[model samples]
Target: DSFNAFMSLNERAARSALLDIQKALGPFRNERVLAATAVTDMAISSLQRRSVTIYLAPNITDMTVLRPLLTLFVQQVMDLLTREHNPDALPVYFLLDEFRQLKKMDEILNKLPYVAGYNIKMAFVVQDLKCIDEIYGETARHSLLGNCGLQLILGANDQVTAEYASRALGKRTIRYQSETRTLELFGRARRTRVEQIRERDLMMPQEVRQMREDKAILLVEGQRPILASKLRYHAIEPFKTAALASRQNTVPVPDVEMARALPVPATLPDYAVDGPDPRPGRIELDRHEVIDDAAFEASSAENVDAAVSSKERLVVTARKLKSVIAACLSAADMPMNQRISIQDVLAKTIPDPEEVGLD
Candidate 1:
């Protein structure tokens, strides 16, 4: 249920993020083309000497729109990089801090190899190993992490994560001193210090905790592992600074409020009522109060096939009617109990169309 909720939240975030971007880039010709091509175009331009930075708050919960928007953005960057006209001198960086917020980490990681040719680099930062597991699942997380040329492990607090990191970093041995007692003759005892060297896997809990708290794991080209000393502080600053700088050069887009304030037609012409209401006021129909004489005969039969068949048909029709009524009630925002009552009514009334005046 937590996983489901997380996914639903992520999807909502993604949708809102895309909407925000669309609002910012207002009135583009060929809207579909604009949506599809904006990221690629921007990436190409960025590669040709422009810098691009997209920033969002850490706690932004809407990911429904965010994932697709980032996917498109990354795809565009990849497309620009892989194209034959890609300039070798210019390099583009797609930096995502706290990357677990987005849902496309695995897809993006899988495509990273292809983007290398375009001189496009990706940097992803997250707080812990478990974040990756939670966001991408275990298999994809492993695959994605493995493909990175560089793995920078900062501090980690969890024992499992630290152990994994310790093994990755390799191990060393150290010597320890201990007190030893020796009895020479029956009456003489001697105490001496003994030094011994022991080997153990490097799984320092303190170091891992420090790394998680203070260090930033930098994975470059998806291979070389390094503990990035400066990244912990500076990872976010560069993007923030870049965004601030761009604000001075950017032209302000018109506010949507002004557009909303424009007068709207009171009614839609197509839906305007032009004649007196056609709802029927009176109906003349023969009501047949039929008694089931055959029912008694059918019930008495040893096989009881007809009775079973009738019951089955009623059950099937009731199910179908209930589904239809449920759908309508759901759309109308009717409470569950009310919806159930409507379903009951439909099940009983719709079994014979003539009763509802439909025959």
Candidate 2:
């Protein structure tokens, strides 16, 4: 019933549905088939009570689709925690790694300042400040840093972030002393000492950039920044040896199996279909059809070049379309969660430009 409501629309309805605000769902969809499913607010409630949960990226896939999915999952869980838990409830720690990869979370991030009242804390691991600025813009970056009462500056590779860390740590007064001695009279030596107190950054920008991996600068509100060494996780009990063994125990999956299991779309994009035949002019339109070796070799280099160029252009067009869709979705007033299903359907509908001729 739901599948028919989604796929069995008139041409006008279908066209309008292309930009339908309802398609923006975050979770639960038929990616391998043409279908739709409803997502409820309680979908992520179970995660709210889970002690430990780790969300990892789908390996080797483009991150565009996964971004909204993860964001929705986190947002829904946070909402549940805020609604159900009291201040005395066990604290929830949201450990988000490479947080800049997700989109449409600025609203949730803005609300993070109040999450602590509900006994929920968040630790965002990012490569650099520039990542947030480039993705979420300057306002969000400021809001995030401003709300963080404690900031840790780790050994960084970028000069900008290093300088930021240096500035944020503020300056300290240092005493400098210079001593000089002269023995001109041969019998006695006179010494002169001059001391001066000057204010300078506790950690210079260059120093922050060159800081060792084991060391980091910790800045807490109303206190001077302190340099601290990091403790290796493996050095801790239970996590060290067990973690290493678990990492080593992972087995690799075959490429074919991995591709089949990946939740990608089943149909080709309309733009990628090569006319009615869906194949090159030389090939027959049957599933079991094959060309003779001699006939295959008879293809001229020009035809091959043309096919390759067409495929490349198709790829460029698909990327441009994705950009357009992202921009449209961002500018729309619809909810981020509601927009995800639409995005997923659009992703599946795109044709594989490389699927040409026979095999």
Candidate 3:
């Protein structure tokens, strides 16, 4: 009784929150979110695993749906790492590109430290540090930077990132030498020795800001900052070949003629029973008659020609309908045997033209 009471409260809270968000979804019209919330008890590890790619196209403007999807994925991956009882699970690589797009990223950043133990690793790709700091706040920003084992900082134009990089490198001591020789009118020259010397940042903020595009700073724990040249992937031997291989040509336009030529599958009883069954073929019409549906029963010769043309069109339409129904049945989630039975019943239920001719 107590457990059920707590569960009811939990359900109420969840429903209120989830429904509010679901109401704003324009793409999921005519569908209730409750059906999506239904859960089945099963072992997650039993499912055949494959690489999961969550590509958020730039065109997607709705963060409400996209953020939840991304959060769910990240949470599941992190959960896998937490399963100490199931250590045999396959390792997962959670790569988040353009990380700023997702909201409430601090939760994920906090889990980064513990992920490695569960065979899960995450790579968060951001354009700049400021982008994340603004979203996750300064505390989360620091935690993220501190937890990462290695950092490759490319040339940064932003003052905040450049200054952060300078501070991150720590201080270095270098010899200072200066000679100030000034000869005033009828005065002797004065020289100053290299007496003023102190520790200074290894790389100044301005220097880091003006760094060459090809140059990057490689920072590793317990190791001196190394200035390295960025790899030119397009020009590299193996990478260049791979890059060219991955390139795709622009998609061609659809063929309207080919689409129009596609025939629909359906059946008509009139064509099956009648002697003349002209369907999906050339309809021989009398030049004197205009093939009018209203004059199908006319006793004149023109009426007879119109009736034949009308019958031919009806048979073609029936065939098209049959094809559509078959496709619909196949697409349904019902069992194969059940679907076949339903389709058979549908075929038989179509009234015979001889028994009930079109009025």
Candidate 4:
């Protein structure tokens, strides 16, 4: 009786389905298809669990191929944070170097303000405020900047960054006095003194731009901002030696707790399998989906047989499929699965037991 349900797949319907698939897959029929699927180690769960995970772009020259891949990986990382987090877990700090270069993470960054509660921390290393404004626009840029508990500005060579840094550090009120001495012909007939209070930026925009390499601004929540000395790590003890070693090695992991330097592979390893699940009660996530009638019709576009009512269409198509059923029966000697493919284009359905002579 299951065969009776899918009794509407006529030649026109089949052609429509084929055309839809062609349209969807048309743009993907290129050499780049391999590059899209080449990345196999997209397992975000285990990678998120590690003390440190790095996504090294294979070729920066091919940004067309690379940025989208980076965007996909970043999305997976964001998704992992949503579903997987322990209450007692330490903050998983994601330090995005060259934050402006990555695209399509605007939506992800929009939610970063609230995700800090999930033990997720984001350190965006941006060159200037203009880049953030250009990439993410004003609203998302505000959200990203508002979420920062600590803002460390090393150098502000650009006016945009310098201005933003100046504003963020805030203003201070200063009191000063001015005395006016009278000349006989002047408007002031007598000496008078006046005191005035004016607000000035804690650090002016020009001052920020002119800040030396050794100097930096540190802005902390609920505290006065500081113009502090940037740590001269090259002059520091262990860091000095580590910096020397980094010139010879690729990854210069500093001497710290759980700082193990592992060799980055040319291609990330893929531990995924295509076979059926071995677990008894595992949910089948990759099975064929049942498309509803309305959805199928919408995707197929305006039907060729608009005059045929759906019920009549099913009856007519079933009558037309008699030849297909006969062809399937001719292959009855073959395995059931082999015989089943004889006329699959007609419909995805089962043959009645009486029609197949099974009973």
Point out the higher-scoring one by TM-score: 1 or 3: 3
23-71 per-residue lDDT for model 2 (tens digits): 6643334452213123233344454455556556554464655556667
Q: How accurate locally is residue 44 in candidate 2, as Cα lDDT from 0 to 100? A: 48
Pick the TM-score winner. Answer: 3
- Candidate 1 root-mean-square deviation in Å: 21.9
For model 3, residues 1-359, the per-residue Cα lDDT tens digits are: 85465456676786775676675454345233233334534444443254444444534665555566556656765665475644665666666777777666555776788877766667787778899778888888888988888888977879889999999988988777877777867797777666566899989999899898889999998898899988898998898888887775546778553222323232333444555544333344554868765454344555456667777767876786687677776768977665556656656546455533465
Least well predicted 10-residue stretch by lDDT in candidate 4: 277-286
Of the candidates numbered 1 and 2, which has the greater lDDT value? 2
Better of 2 and 3 by TM-score: 3
**Evaluated with lDDT, which candidate comes out highest?**
2
Pairs of residues clashing in candidate 2? 23-342, 24-338, 24-339, 24-340, 25-338, 25-341, 268-351, 269-350, 269-351
- Residue 82 in model 1: lDDT: 60
Residues 1-359 of candidate 4: C-alpha lDDT, one tens digit per residue:
53453356787876777697676455355445444565555455554456656655555666654665576667777777768557765467778888777864865776676777787877888888778889778777777788888999999889888999989988999998999977676564778899999999988999999889898899898898988997777898799999988877887569763323444442223312444322322222334676676766564443433323444655655776776667666867987566555357445344454444345
Ordered by TM-score, highest first, the candidates read 3, 4, 2, 1
- Pitting candidate 1 against candidate 4, the one with the higher TM-score is 4
Indicate the worst ten consecutive residues by lDDT in candidate 3: 257-266
RMSD of each: 21.9, 19.8, 14.8, 19.5
lDDT of 3 at 46: 42
